[model samples]
Target: MTIKNSGKFIIQKEKLIIYLFVLSVVFADILGNGNLNLLYFFGLFLIFKNLKIQVSFLKDMVIFFVPFCLMILGEIFLSGNTFSPVKVLVYSLKILVCISLLSYTKKRFWVVDHLTIIKNICGLFEIMLVISLLTINKPIFWRLNDVINRFSKTRLKFLYSEPSVLGILCGLLVIILLYYIFDNKKNYMLLKEIVLLAVIILLTFSMSGIVYTAIGIIVLFLFQVFKNKEVIPRRMLTYFLLGICLLIIILSTNNPISNRFFSMFLGTDGSYNFRWSAAVNVFRKTMEITRYWGMGLGNMNTPSGLSFLLNIGIDYKFANSFLYFFTENGILGIIYTIYLFLICTYNCIKSSKNIRPLKVGVLAFAFVSQIAGGYYTDPILWIMYGIVCSNEKTVIN
Candidate 1:
């Protein structure tokens, strides 16, 4: 190829890889079962194959790596956990892959139109959700399972491992789609996308998803009110009251969604109870035993306090991400995690006004990551951090 053609080819290849990496992050749950996510592996392979190790990328890696190595090694030697080394190795590899992915995205696509990517992701999610529902009983590639329950029978997982994953992701997607609605004015297409995502979240019967959506909407409304001083706060107040009325209506009904919502508040929802009650206690006891350090990476899989509270023979881990990180990596890990967010917040603040909405979506995702299920190795989480920390010379229009 000519030199000009070769330059065009390289740019095209970069765009293709960027899209593929994003797809891997979004649909990572179905890429493989359990912790062995094929998509994550695929992402690492792509990054390494097209490796361009910049100084900044190395800096980002070291900042996160030093703390991780300290915690894992400390637990292995100081805590004397027999299984700690193997688990630490596995977890470290996953973290390395995610950090590399983050660095590549920040360096390459810093000025790209992220709104287009967000919209495309929402479209793909809608397509997958429809296919999953249509093939609910057929055991197709998109439908993970025909989930049945007392409320919202036949939940749609949409290529993910479970309903809650789909739900929480869709909830986050709604907030992101909303972020693209410039000037707080939702065009027809944006409105439709948000509504569709909200419906998907409802169908999954994910309490965390519902709560995130509610909170996200409130945040956006408040954001608009503050950004446009001419607008009255009554708009936000009206939404709050409307939300209360809707809750009352839903609570009065005899449906699966309502039952799940009611059960959550009553502490009767098994999933909710397991996440907050048992998981919280397990985190607390692990912290006490581990002191300022941690139980070490991958120690949660061992026979810990979770089994006693769960009353199960097998081992379990905390489903809440905040508790999981705290129990495994202790105070230092927690501080590093916070620092990542603070860095994102600071960078986004320094970025152009057009991209500020993304800051809100990122913060909302951060909150959901804590309450919703998933580990620190979650690609979507890292991707958010990457996008927020991208080049400051962003042009969203």
Candidate 2:
């Protein structure tokens, strides 16, 4: 083959690796034991293939890994628990592989060109949603609900183990769809995408998903009105209003989804109260035990700590990511996370002129997920961070 053809082949191979990485992320929980680790191994191999050792990149990796190392040390010295070096090593390796893959992808694919990739990922998620809806009653897929009681009313978990996972995945798509809708006013197809994602999100009965979807739509609308000085076209406005009306009607009715969304705020939801109390107790206990340093990476849900919380009537694991980090990595973890957040925000602001709205929307979704929990270590979050912080020049094709 000619050199040009060889180059094309190499690009195609890299893109295939990226696609596999995305699939691994989406199905990480569903694939069962050791599957995610295998995917990470492949990802690391691909990243190593193109990896150029840079002092700056190595420094960033070291800085990011410090908290994990400190957590391991804390667990050994502070917590009178078994020092599981294997756990620490595995967790650190997974993180390193994720970051390396992200860095490689950012350097290979420009951020402006990422719309196509995002759309493809959304397409895969939509396919998964459809399959989930269809197989909700099938015995083969019932094992996916093992995390939750099978006797209870089922939620649309799809290929995921929990409804909230599906909800968050759908929520990410919703943000992307809204990004396209606002970023390109003439793209009429985005309306249908938005409607479909909204339907999927509602099916999951996740309050966080519902809230973030609304936030994305509102942020996009306001940005268009205020920043771009664009008037809402009458027909488009009519459709938007009608959609909102439908959502309101849905929420007002006495259905599982509506109850799940509203009962949390009304203080009638036992699960919500349990999660809130658990989060509070965990935070309090962690603060008392490890005021500056954390209890340890693996100590967040320690059986003894959990037993203590349960003895006091708080029966649940930590559901809030902020609290989880604070308890696991202590004050230093919070500081590091905040620093990364600020860097991502600053980079998004600096690159606003080139696909600014999309970055802002992505960042908003990630921030909301972090606050609401269940997405602290999501690959999508890191992918967005890599894209936002990447220094690659935008190609305006």
Candidate 3:
């Protein structure tokens, strides 16, 4: 084959790897639930086959893993709480592999025009969501009271574990699409994708998705408004009217989405309240037991103590990522995370101005990860970080 053909083949291969890798993670619930995600493993395997390990990346790993290992060992040896050695091992491996894969993908794909690949993936999910909506009320498509229901009606999860999970995923995609739309001078299709993703998020009735979407919008709007003074007062007025319209909808509509948000503020929403309170309770209990050090890695199980806490009679991790980090790794972990975050933020500030949307998107997702999502091994979080930390001189388009 000619050199041009070889180049085309390589690009196609990269696109394929990215598509499969992202799809596996997105459908991890269906393919592999719990600690053992089949698709996640498969994705990592693909990454390893293609990934070029760098000395700098290895050094960064040491920075992350040393503290992680210390936390795990501390939990096993010092903390008198019930812990699982298998979980510790599995979680550690997953985090290492996930970060490695993300770093590789960022260098190979995100810094290039292969970003069209992500947009294509977003289109694929958008199609699935549209189909699910079209088939609403059908046998399997509309199962009522199955995990996440809104007023006895099935919320659109689209084959993911639950609506919240699906919503979070959609929210991330929406942010990416928004970035694409903002960066590109001519992006009519990107705009449509963001709109569809937003609709899907709303249909899921996930407060997390709604919040993430709002944050993304605000971040992008502010960045654009400051970058270009032309949109100042008109855009501000449009946003004000938009917010008012949203408020009116929430107040007037008696649907599950509206009710859920209302209950959330009133502290009556079970999911919202439990997610927040449980993480806090776990952190508090862990601190009390370990004297604020931590309960160690993969050791989020609440010990038998106060009966008032929202301890569901099962071994579970905290839904909040930051609290989870503190509960597991303590002060050192918090310091490390904060330091990493600052570095990432600084890098983003120094990067190209066109990629500001992605910087904001990553930051928004990071906030949502702490509140509505957790687990150190979450690939999406690492993936966003990788993309944002790509070559500073590279153009995202």
Candidate 4:
């Protein structure tokens, strides 16, 4: 009896720890620098406590960690960046710890329960959004603007460091809310929640978020239409029209949000050109130095800087996520990473019929946003991957 009771206590403790970890991940930006560091330390401790350290886990870790380490080594030896390896190691450790924690939790809990946990995390973000709205007059709640271009218009970032960051978070929540609405047809609350999330994401003015969310909504609508024999359900059509109306109204306004869509793509703006140039420069530099292997991972932004792009005052350090992976880890690193992605995607599709649309939506949102927004360091992306690849069967024992 005592042994059984002790086991239950341990399980409960681990569950609480997992919840804490989720909170930390969702609110990492809002937690402040010092507080966030403390949360990470606590997370590491919980991960250590729950970790079983089996051979399989070790193998998985090596598969994930080796590419990153090789990139760092390349930067050190080939690129002659002595000081960058520490930064790379720190970044890699955070990802490693998150991967380990999610893997451990998935083994003990049902995948549906993991979905619930993620939903709760989204709920917390909504709470934060409410607080941010209330505190908009405060200096801390002010929007972020371009530091180099002082004349550029500011965009709403809320509690995050940038508009795109807030957009990514809200975009994921919108996907989750959409999934809930599809899964529970009678849930009126979810429909309203989706509207609210959609508004928040638009307010962020993140082009990546807007595009990804638009694509996800379209895909979901198509899936429903196909499933129902090409018949568009009245309720779904009504909601779709309502969403379109909201977007039209929002875009008609003379706000920064409206301006972003026009200015981002205009040739005179140079933003699109800048992104292209950044990606090209990174790839060109990587290819110039190494053919099969990469130049190592610490910072791909060469110290001497790329040709005319850097000279023109554009910082080409962070390119698209996939491009960054190729430049940092070379061809093999990207292949291995893509293999992992394909495996996760395959599992998600195989289990789509058994799982809620929320799982599938999360997977879709993560893939699209990561590719478009260059959020290579985001923990939520990896967490979603872990959830999608988890076993479909609910824990019975």
Candidate RMSDs in order:
3.7, 3.9, 3.8, 4.4
What candidate 3 gets wrong by more than 4 Å, as runs, is: 1-8, 50-52, 55-63, 70-83, 112-115, 134-143, 146-153, 183-185, 228-240, 301-318
lDDT of 3 by residue, 29-131 (tens): 7753655564567646744774576664666566555666765666566655566677677787887776665566556544555546656656677777768
Candidate 1 stretches greater than 4 Å from native: 1-3, 22-27, 108-110, 139-150, 182-187, 228-253, 303-315, 348-354
| Better-scoring candidate (lDDT), 1 or 4 | 1
* CA lDDT for candidate 2: 0.63
On the 0 to 100 scale, the lDDT of residue 31 in model 4 is 60
Model 4's lDDT to the true fold? 0.61
Best-fitting candidate, scored by lDDT: 1
Residues 49-113, candidate 4, lDDT per residue (tens digit)? 64667764576567555655665555566654334656566667876765665455435436335
Q: Write the per-residue lDDT of candidate 1 for residues 134-222, one digit (tens) a residue.
A: 67666553333333244555666666777766766677667666665534444447777777888788777766667766676566555
* Cα-based lDDT for every prediction: 0.67, 0.63, 0.66, 0.61
How accurate locally is residue 62 in candidate 2, as Cα lDDT from 0 to 100?
65
Which 10-residue window in model 2 sums to the lowest lDDT?
Answer: 143-152
Q: State candidate 3's TM-score.
A: 0.83
